[model samples]
Target: MDSLILNILTPVAIFLFIALFTLFAVYAERKIAGFVQDRLGPMETGKYGLLQTFADILKLLQKEFISPSASDKILFALAPILIFVAVFVGYSVIPWGPNLIPSNTHTGLFFIMAVVSIDAIGILMAGWGSNNKYSLLGSIRAIAQMISYELPVGLSLIAAVMITQTLNLNEIAFNQGLLSSKEIYFLGFWKVNEIGGIFGWNIFQAPHLMVSYAIFFIASLAECNRAPFDIPEAESELIGGFHTEYGGIRFAFLFLAEYAMMFLVAMLGVVIFLGAWNSPLPNIGPAKLADWTTGPVWGVFWTLIKSLFIVAVQIWIRWTLPRFRADQLMTLCWKILIPLAFVCMAISGLWRILIMI
Candidate 1:
């Protein structure tokens, strides 16, 4: 009975959380944009426009549904649902903290990477189904960008898996905390205990994995179709891109899915590279407070803090840089990121083998 209750409630809780988080994220993006541009944002809807996002949600719900007359009605309708569901379901394999994961599978990492990639298909459907030339162009751009960058994303992760030798995200998180057996050494000079939690994280594991993390972060930005790399939705060219034909709640789903994907990739970076839910330090000095403050509950809190920081960086980059040209986008992925990822993986693998010998 307890297990069944947990199984039933987890997805419900995550769904509600994603919905609410998307509202705040939208508000945050607007405020951040205003700050960047030297203006105040949305002051009238509520204090600092706190209610603005909620108001927007209500307005969307009440808005009349409009569909492109030329669109394939079935695929047009199904697109938003698939995109939203793909992002939402990817959360199932992520372990929030001890016993907080919805599903504890050995192949959690592979499962997440696979599930998140499904959004590409939905995106293609949205573009092709809409029957707009611009929409088709945007969808083609999306497929190309996703496929190009996904190679680096997976390869970067391979470096970490080589070190940890497991795909279970919970184990990945556990190995970063002070209680785990993984140890860090300083060029064979000094040994850092697991209590040196941040030092034990994969990003700091070796020179190669550090490069891997850098590649992973960049690829993830492209994966989520955010910022300078967001060529698929280049407003100057494609209007609203693949989602141009959608309105009302259909548009809302697509919008929410984008933000949710941002959050999801940010969390994945934290888990695979930045130490997941573990505190940045072991029980030492001021960091000793983490010993008490860094349990399962605190794990969730830390994870959110890290993930939100990444999101903030994404927003900052979005406002700071110009969008990449299509050729530049492809060149960066294939010529630069993919090769760098391969070198990083090879170096990390060699380091692991050397240490064992």
Candidate 2:
């Protein structure tokens, strides 16, 4: 009975967190855009425009749900919910802290990748059900882009997995912390298990993973349909892409899913490469910064801080880089990222063999 109740509340907590995060993320994006473009973003709506996203949410809630006259009503209505659910479900296996994961599946990483791919089907349904040419084109671009990028994303993550030898995300997180059961040496020489800081991170432990992380980051941007790689929703060309026909609450759900995807990918990157929930400070001499800052609560804190920093970088890149032409986007994914990802995977294997020797 207690376990059942906990399971029920876990999803509720995740939903609330996603909702609040979407609100803050939208506001932050607008302000970030304003800063980039040299203009005040939302000064009029409450103090420092803090309430702007809330106001926008209320407006969206009150707006009418409109569908195209000749559209397949069932699929059109179901698309947003399906898309949002696909992204939302990916959070279940995410290890927020040592004890905070909603579901600590052994194949947590595999589960996230599989579930998140379902959104492509939802995107296709949105485009096809609308019976609009632009919508169909946008969905095609999204499918192509996502499928193409998944290669690099998978390969890059495989590099990390090769090093960790576990698909359990919590175990991966543990391996990066001071209390790791396995011994880790810096550059296969200096034992760093006792000194857990940036040194213990996968990127530092296996320097080749820095390349893997880069490939993962670039591919993640495409996965999230973020700017530069946001060909699916190119405002100038597709006029909102696969979601062109959606409005009101349906559109809101799609929007929310996009932001949630952004956060999800960022958090995944943090867990795999940026030390997960472990503190970046190391114990040295008389100072015990890492030991003091390490706990369930601190785990959550460090995880969020690292994840948000990655999100901020995503936002900055969105505003800084111009949108990629469809051809250029595909070329980068197939030719450049895929090759680099393979190299990283090879390096990960070699690194592991050398360490064992």
Please report, in order, the local distance difference test score of every candidate based on alpha carbons.
Answer: 0.86, 0.92
Provide the TM-score for each candidate, comma-separated.
0.96, 0.98
lDDT of 1 by residue, 1-357 (tens): 999998999999998888988999999999998899899988999888999999999999988978788889999999999999999989998878765788989999999999988999999999999999999999999999999999999999998888878999988877765656655553323465535557666677666777888899899999999879988998888997899899899999999999999999999989888878877755577557547766888889988999999989988888878889999999899999999999988877788889733
Error of 2 at 308 (Å): 0.7
Residue-wise lDDT of candidate 2 within 1-357, one digit each (tens)? 999999999999889999999999999999999999999999989999999999999999999989989999999999999999999999999988876788888999999899999999999999999999999999999999999999999999999999999999989999986978898766567789988987888877777888899999999999999998999999999999999998889989999999999999999999998889989999997898899988999999999999999999999999999999988898898889999999989988888887745
Number of the top TM-score candidate: 2
Q: After superposition, how far is residue 308 of candidate 1 from its true place, in Å?
A: 0.8
Off by over 4 Å in 2: none
* Residue pairs with backbone atoms closer than 3 Å in model 1 (clashes): none
Q: Which is the leading candidate under lDDT?
A: 2
